[model samples]
Target: MVLVQNTNWNNAAKALKNISTATNFQLDKILNLSDKELEKLVMPSGYYHNKAKTVRNVLGMYQTSFSELKKLDTDTLREKLLAIKGVGEETADVMLLYLFNRPVFVADNYTRKFFSKYFKQKFTYASLRKNIMKNFAFTVKDAQEFHALLDVYGKQNK
Candidate 1:
């Protein structure tokens, strides 16, 4: 049984339609592209192709390997997600942290720039993710919210 069945099919269909409208291609064609190739095809703002490829790969991985993702433990699922193409640590962490209610911090360019500017810290992406996770006593929601808040703060302060 699919734990989280495609309950949002209508929303997914609508989003697919929007992508189709914007890109002039059917959903199937979009899905056919690999992550890196798809990333090259789409407009930067759309990021749709990359996202679609990731979703397709992830769903296929879950269906084929685990039967249902909700049945897997958080760490197991994170590992599974990281194995897929285009599924980096941040993306996997975001999926675990938000979708699966796991405690994990996601760091992106905004977080890195904001923190570096204010804290005068120099760290690579991996180290930055680790540093943020170590320093913040925040839930997944808090991390998301804080990231948004930092983006706003940076924009205004700039």
Candidate 2:
């Protein structure tokens, strides 16, 4: 669910460490900050400044309200995540499918490209996701495995 390409994690950690060096706040405190506060805390990370605020707010809301995010039903959690700023259908679907073990097909550029080439028709994200779910054997485990296999095949072919 936390799809950091190894190098990105190191870079992000280093940046966070630099920010922490100046601010006395701990990681937990920073993470729990309100949306506006978080926007100020994580400044100038390109477009991530606004995104960080949304992420923090959503996380804080879930932490305070749910106390255990993993316990929420996938559909409920997806809807909740979608309500947060900066979290669109793709992000919500990623959290539900990857993080919450829901049966969902994440329609990104790669998915769209592959499907379009195979089907010879342009497909929107909603339509593509629905097509996969409706046509394939719909199960969380199966969706996960199929997605993984598709990624592997894509990489190999590339």
Candidate 3:
């Protein structure tokens, strides 16, 4: 979901899928790629240099395969990723929701402005997310998808 974070230019998902397809969705394959190679692959996503670095850095820490990554619990994985420099609340939440299969809602700037206006409630990354989970965590995947769909709607309406 690092790709989701960098979707400012072009179609971000396509750019990311291109890189994933080139590397065959393998962590080690992507890690073996030099910075320049990864940068070029991600150039269409915008902020190629920094986004490439963030991807490499995250993959560097997670050198093992996805099967191994699947063994970790959501909180442990979230804690580890959050400790990384490039991972923020939204990015970490994305990793937790999408990658770790946790029921986390990624609260972006859109979430804040939209929720504040509509719900008449102030929010921070922490508080808004807490309330979202409190209200929507009736089931795991459902809650995760709700967040994703909400984000897409917010972005489109903006």
Error of 2 at 91 (Å): 0.7
**lDDT of candidate 2 over 54-86, digit per residue (tens):** 556655665576546568876688778778776
TM-score of 1: 0.59
What does the lDDT read for residue 10 in candidate 1?
47
- lDDT per residue for candidate 1 within 1-158, as digits (tens), equals 01112223344455545556655655455566666655454333344565556666765665566557757886788777788886887667767766676666666556667778878986677898777667768776786677668657755765
Clashing pairs in 1: none
Scored by TM-score, the top model is 3
Worst 10 residues of 1 by lDDT: 1-10
Q: Can you rank all candidates by lDDT, best first? A: 3, 2, 1
Per-candidate RMSD, Å: 8.1, 5.0, 2.7
TM-score of each: 0.59, 0.65, 0.79
lDDT of each: 0.61, 0.65, 0.76
Error of 3 at 120 (Å): 3.0
lDDT of 3 by residue, 10-106 (tens): 4577777778788987887888888899988887777788888888877876665456666778777777788877778888887777667777677
Deviation from native of the Cα of residue 85 in model 1, angstroms: 1.4
Off by over 4 Å in 1: 1-17, 20-52, 62-68, 71-73, 154-158
Task: Tell how far residue 65 is off in model 1, in angstroms.
Answer: 6.6
* Residue 31's lDDT in candidate 3: 84
